[model samples]
Target: MSGVASTRQQEVQRIVDSLSMAIAQHRLKPGMRLVEAQIVDVLSANRNHVQAALQRLALQHIVTIAPNRGAKVARPEAREAREVFIARRAIEHAILAGITIGKMALHNDEIEAHLQAEEVAAASEDRRHIIRELSQFHLLLANISDNRVLSEMFSNLMVRSSLIVALYQRNDTPDCQCQEHRAVITALRAGEVARAQAIMDEHLRHIEQQLELDDAPPPPITLRDALLVSW
Candidate 1:
């Protein structure tokens, strides 16, 4: 019984992680419907498993499940968009305040690796991949802070931020700028904690500025396109 239950939990977690990655990557945009049959097909999971995954996501505010409409990626409101950034600024500021030269040194290798990945993704000009890489870079910084509680909090913020970006971002603006990330790293390497924190604050502000919160929402894509794993 324990073994079977554990396997079931793992399967559910697997589905949730995949969907979360797609959402964070901007491959699955806000307001996109998540058809169960399509999700089951794309993930090769059972119907029950897919449904369970969607339920978990809904609890996280990552998806919305309607009585008759089924589930769709969450569409955050304009007010919620501003609130998300405010929350992010507070959380990220705390994370940066705790950083030290020794701590930064510990994660230097991982940081460099993530930066390289970001550069490669940017060079490819694959928007989805670039978005995912950029988001992961921030998450990596949180993890480097070595505070599990803070890291988990930032993880949730990243998800909400992703949804907000999907709903409110302008077509012409880039999701993240690689040069800004590099600048933050350079500041940290020089033991200029204040400068690094300032850079991060500026970076977050730049991302939020790209959003057109007052603009009309985009038309939702077809279920097939939404669930297509390749996209």
Candidate 2:
């Protein structure tokens, strides 16, 4: 009995992780519909477990659930974008500072593994995979920071940021902001904390500049449409 419960929990976690990664990479965008049947099909999980995962994301505000609309990724106002970036800047600044002060270093094998994954994603033709890699790069840093709370917070923010980018992205470069990752990694490897932080700031600044937020209206969809629609 306990084993069955544990397996269900694990499946729920896997669904959440996969969806979060998809969100961060812009594979899932703001205002994009999340249909339960479709999600269950894609995640290959039961409807109940998928529902559990969606509930978890809602707690982080990464997704929103309307009474009859089911759930969709969160689409923040332009003002919210600015607010999010402000918070991100503060959070990442502290993360980098902690890494510097603690002189925390990533394992060589781990770094190489991440880089290899990035390369594979970059080389792939799938836009979704590319976006996933871009988002994971930032998450990897949070993990390296070794602060559990901050890591979880960053994970949630990363999901939201991906949605924002999808709503406002100005270019189609799958490899965007990748060089900045290399720069930060290099600085960290050299024990140059100041350089690492500088690289991150520049990287984030570039992302902010790329948003094309010009007050486009949300695509027309009512509560009825979302519920009736499969995906």
Candidate 3:
């Protein structure tokens, strides 16, 4: 019984991650409805798992479920976007505490490797991959922090941040600054927790400031385009 339940849980989480990645990468645009039947077919996932996954996302505030309407990618309002950044600063502060100043940072190689990949992706100009790579940078830090609870909290925020940025961001806003990320690594390695946190604060603010929240919300895309995204 436990084995079966574990399998079911894993399947549900798989669906959730796929949807989260699609949303983060801009393939699943905000305001687009997520039809369960289509999700089941497109993901080859059972209906129950798809339903469970969507419910989990709703709990994360990454998806919205209306009374009569089905689930849709969450389109955060301007005020909500500001609140998210505020919450992000708090979470990142905790994440830094786990870094343990004066100690060698774990995942040093992985850090440099991801930074290289970020630069390459930025140069490639593949918007989907670039966005995914940039977001993964924070996820990597969460992993490095080795606090599962904090990691989960930040992961949820990170995914929601992507959605907010996609909806409210200015057309001219460039990808996250690669140089700022490098500066963060340097600060962390030097056991400069305050400096690292400061860089991260500035980095996040730069992204949020670029959002044209006064403008209209992004238009809803078709359900098919939303669900047809490949994992």
Candidate 4:
């Protein structure tokens, strides 16, 4: 019984982490169906545990579950996407401003550690993990602001924002390593607040521009039709 429970817990954690990473890296778009059986197969876990994990993600607004529809990745509206970025810019700019004036506090060692971690994750072959690490960079920015409330708010939004980024991303970058982040960090360390803010702004704008809002999705055909055509 204990072993079963342990495995269940691990499965649930794995599902959460997988989805979270997916959202962070823009590999999973908003509104993508997460069919229960498919999730079970993907996670290599039992259906029951996958269901439980889906429910947990729903609570985080990372996924939405509906009657008869089951679970799908959460899709933020266009307005929501704009709002998320707006909030991010405001908070991050403030953090930069504070740092410029020597009002903000952050540990150099911590920032260095996160940068190293980001490098590793960015270089990782696993796209999902890279996405998670990218999303986490914003969380680290929030922490540097020394406001727990802001940190928590950014954390919640990062999950949703990641989905937005994935849904909108049109161009495939060669790697997840954000040169913009590195630039921002460099400027911040040098007490160049304006430079950091500019880099951050450019980064956000580039991400926004890469989303494919006007591109039409490919037409869907029924399996029967596909089979007929193949014949």
Candidate 5:
């Protein structure tokens, strides 16, 4: 029975991760409902498993479970959106400070690979791929920070940042600047930790500035259609 229970838990976690990735990749926009029936069909999972997965996401604040509206991707409030960036500034700054010149050199190839992928996605004009790759660049830096705890914290922030961008960013605003990413890399390569940190701070600030937090909320769209088109 215990083994059966553990297997069930793993299955639920798999669904949770899949949905989380869809949200983080921006394919699943903020305020979009997550219909359990559609998820069960899309993923070929049990209804119970789908419900458990959504509950887990709700705990993480990635999904919100209302009294009667069911689960929907969280649309963070303006205040919460500001807080996310503020938290990012502190956490990302720490990530840069913790990285020594030696560590940066060690991870150089991996970091460049992510940047190359971002460039390719941008040139191809694949908006979805571009968003995913751009987010990966920051995650790559967090991985190189060599602090597992901080890396995990940064990962959560990145996820929330994606939601914030989806909810607040202007339609015409680009989420990431490849040149700025390259500049940070150059600073790291030159062993200028402070420069790298400063550039990262500015980059994050620019991203925040692009958001139209005061804009009215977008109308809700069908979850099944979003999942079908995106998946």
Candidate 6:
């Protein structure tokens, strides 16, 4: 019975992860509707598992569920957007602090590879790909920090931030800057954790500063289009 239950939970988690990735990739815009029936059909997943997965996302504040409206990607309010950034600043600070100078092993090549991917995406002007890459850079740093707990916390925050950006970003505002990511890596490689932390703070603050945060209406996007790539 336990094994059966575990398998069921794993199935539910697969749905949860796919949806979360879609959200983090910016393919799933804020307030985009997620009809359970459509998702079950698109992914050929069990309706029960699909509902469970969305409930999980709701628990994480990544999605919102309404009695008759089903679920939609969360549309953070202006105040919630500001608070999300504040929370991220705290979480990311702790993640960076775990990388003490000369204590934790750092991997530059992996991050460099990620940066290269970001460059390729930028060259092609693939906005969605670029957004995914930018967010992954932070997740990469969290992994390198070697604090699994912090990594998990920051991962959730990254997705929430994605929603915040999608909803409130200024028209002229650009996606996360790769140069800033490179700077963070450079500071880390030089054993300057404090400098790296400062860069990260400035980087995040710049992104936050770019937000219009006026409760812009969430744009239109189909749930199938958002979750298709993930499946």
Clashing pairs in 4: 25-131, 168-211
Q: Rate the local accuracy (lDDT) of all candidates.
A: 0.83, 0.75, 0.84, 0.69, 0.83, 0.83
Which pairs clash inside model 2? 25-131
Candidate 1 regions exceeding 4 Å error are 173-176, 215-231
Q: What TM value does model 4 have?
A: 0.64
**Candidate 6 Cα deviation (angstroms), residue 87:** 0.9
lDDT string, candidate 3, 156-217, tens digits = 99988988888887753357578988998888888888999999999998887788886455
Predicted structure with the largest lDDT when compared to the true one: 3
Instruction: Please list the residue runs of candidate 3 whose C-alpha ends up more than 4 Å from where it truly belongs after superposition.
Output: 101-105, 215-231
Residue 187, candidate 6: C-alpha displacement in angstroms: 1.0
Q: TM-score for each prediction?
A: 0.88, 0.79, 0.92, 0.64, 0.88, 0.93
Clashes of 1: 0
**Model 6: per-residue Cα lDDT at residue 145:** 80
Query: Which scores better on lDDT, 2 or 6?
Result: 6
Give the runs in model 2 whose Cα sits over 4 Å from its true position.
Answer: 1-5, 100-106, 116-126, 215-231
Evaluated against the true structure, the overall lDDT of model 1 is 0.83
Runs in model 6 deviating more than 4 A are 100-106, 172-176
Question: What does candidate 6's lDDT look like per residue over 118-229, in tens digits?
Answer: 8887776766777877888888878878888888788888999988888877852356488888888777777888898899999999898878878776667788888777
lDDT of 4 by residue, 145-215 (tens): 67776666666677777777666666544245467777887887787888989998988777777676542
Decoy 6 TM-score against native: 0.93
* Residue 173 C-alpha lDDT in model 1: 35
How accurate locally is residue 102 in candidate 3, as Cα lDDT from 0 to 100? 38
TM-score of 5: 0.88
How far in Å is the alpha carbon of 185 misplaced in model 3?
Answer: 0.2
